[model samples]
Target: MTQPSGDPAATGVPTCYRHPDRETWIRCQRCDRPICPDCMRDAAVGFHCPQCVQEANRSSRQNRAVYGGERSADPRLTSYVLIAINALVWLGVLATGWKNSDLIARLALVPKGTCESLSSDGYYPTALGERLCTLGTQGDGHWVPGVADGAVWQLITSQFLHVEVWHIAGNMLALWMLGPQLENVLGRTRFLALYLLSGLAGSVAVLWLSGAGQLTLGASGAIYGLFGAYAVIAHKVRADLRSIATLVAVNLFITFAVPNISWQGHLGGIAGGALVAAVLAYAPRARRTQVQALGLGGFLLVLVALVALRVAALS
Candidate 1:
């Protein structure tokens, strides 16, 4: 006997590197390692072993969006969730009694506390309620807390509130139309941050500009913010400007022309969105994420300071 050759190939049987028990003639194109059917992964040219495929994946770069955000697998999912929340809240408000609903009393953004009558028109002064008129004395009503009264939760909650069917309908329509497109470009996380901050900016504007007892509620402010953000992004990517400009102009007309509309909130939201979009779109690729985060943080601090200043002034 010639000592039966040392190589397994001498017996016309070569085992897979990963599975020694299985015999295979196929070899990985990259590593030239024998790969059994179980370990084989299809490649551009020939099959590759599991190890080689994983190595190739590890070395490959991840795909990113224009603003340096990771590409979202489903861009519309976030928008859908937001819509669901607003819808659920609207349904709850309807069930409770629309405008008379205690839910609205607690959620709507009231700049200053108001003594409202449940069975009558016109709000009474808090002092009058304590002296000449009480909750059940002159009328049936309760004292609704305002932002200045430490009802800070209203800043965000008011965004989801709506008493009119047309109001919620129009706002939800605009959101559905604009949200996914923006989310696709900026990714879910960035898009959501832009939305929430823009909405808060509107609330802050209400705190500063509207009458102390004025009631402001609806998603129009945030919707306007999206319009402004879309315009910035459109300009950044060099998309057509005519449509967005026309849309914005039309909305502005509606904001001012329509009675009871919060022009302050709309204008503030647009300005905030434009500033934020500029920060996100123009950040340098070098240290891009860090720069964006710092810029957003600075903007948030400015808003908080504005809120604090308003609170101090109220006090």
Candidate 2:
């Protein structure tokens, strides 16, 4: 009796072990192992071995779980929301029909003495008043009374304000790309804390470096804070460092190349965020909870000290 031509035992045809009746012509792209139609899976326009396919599926599922299985948790979404908010605020200013709008100055943080007159009468001036005071004039190196009178609050608020749409858009884009992943790893609370502290550090740097002249606004400081956090976290998790370095270099280039960019704020935020992250990452793992509490407490104390010093300076 003559054997079949395509039979494995006859002409060396590779038979599908599972489906003995079939001959396999394709190989798994990943494992490079032979597989029949039933065993092969389509993976990005190519076939995959059963074991490789299973492993890839498992990885994908794990990633999905980490991302909360929702598309909105995408880092880009956070960035978009921030940009939208800033744009809306700008539009609101335009809609209010105010001429010579001082919207940015009013909401932005300034140095001491730059707006001292506005701080008179025991009441910090209105946002509009602050804007009016800083108009047609620049500030100097130290925190000005009226300019950054309530700078403690400005630390957080300043992250949302911007002098230009492009400025806000750029910062938001960076934030959107970097924030979610950091948030995912650090969890929302820690991430938020890092952002706030980083912004504060940036504001403080501005106060120390510029003194009172230039009016600073925008989220770059806080976004840079995220960059700082990213570096620390990447190291802790053994993630690729090259990517983080690339991001830092690109942003630094932008800061230097672009006119009117706040290099102080960027540096301050990066430093602060990295400091905090280092404390968080390097502290003994067994005492992580205690260490985190202590770190947070220290931050709060520093914040309070800054506020008290500003008030004392005014008096």
Candidate 3:
């Protein structure tokens, strides 16, 4: 039998067993094994043994499986696309000479005024509640009363109506940046549910807090909700907490510094997203799916109830 080539007891210099003449100064970072230059691969963090390189690749693939397979797959969340669509619609409205059209009046959540208009035109009331005061002059600069009537559908539709180009652009930018990662992690359905619910919660908060003085319209509520969800999930998974905290702080600063921004919507959306995330994250694994579904359903129902009450109150 051939004798081993290198001195086995040398310090600092690891002699290759196969080639005793060659000494290795670097240790493989992955396995901490002594390896010659011929058997080393440069990795992002450090050098790895050939065997460890293969194992690292294998582990990366396994983790990808839990993230819904292929790294290049499309995101489940559609918030970015939705933002684009809303922008396109705004442009189309401008192009069609409808820039000043009452599109928002028709689609936005102006509970009191909408209910009154519908009721006067023969719509039946659906719920019993106090009539909310309406703010701002309506079409042709005419003062309209009870614009704050609490219509639930407004909660969903309000997210699509922005008061200005800058408003929509800001919200869309945030959505585009944060939405893909969330959609990937939560899957499409859950991501969408969170967005819609957050928007509704924000609208509700505005109605409650402004109580008919402010005419609120924007997607910031939903966007803030996405941030809230990310923060909660990051904590639960022990992800990089610093990143989430930075995002929250930057957005909060903007909300406060900017004039005419809807702080109520931001707060409401954040609270709603965090609450839903907590419910989903803490439920028993077996019951988690059911709990998420039921929770979403209940939230939607409450939104509908609010809308009905607003309609009835105005009537």
Best by lDDT: 1
Note the residue pairs that clash in candidate 3.
111-149, 111-150, 112-148, 112-149, 113-146, 134-146, 134-147, 151-307, 152-307
Better of 1 and 2 by TM-score: 1
Summarize candidate 3's per-residue lDDT along 1-315 as a digit string, tens digits.
977635644444676534566787777887787778887789888788888888878876543312232332578337657877778766755564343445555455554553222332221221222233133122112323344433445667668876567777888888888888777776676777778888888887776665453456778888899899889888888999898899899989988898877898999899888876666556565666777678778877886677556545546
Could you tell me which 10 consecutive residues in candidate 2 have the lowest summed lDDT? 118-127
What's the C-alpha lDDT at position 188 in model 2? 56
lDDT of 2 at 217: 75
In model 3, the runs with Cα more than 4 Å from the true position are 1-73, 96-99, 114-152, 302-315
For residues 16-98, write the lDDT of model 2, one tens digit per residue. 65577778878777767778988987788788877886787677645432212222344445445656776776675566532
TM-score, one value per model: 0.82, 0.62, 0.63
Clashes of each: 0, 17, 9
Candidate 1, 119-181: lDDT as tens digits: 653322332322333445646656777888889888889888887889889888888999999
Best by TM-score, which number?
1
Model 2 residue 281 CA deviation in Å: 2.7
Q: What C-alpha lDDT does candidate 2 achieve relative to the native structure?
A: 0.66
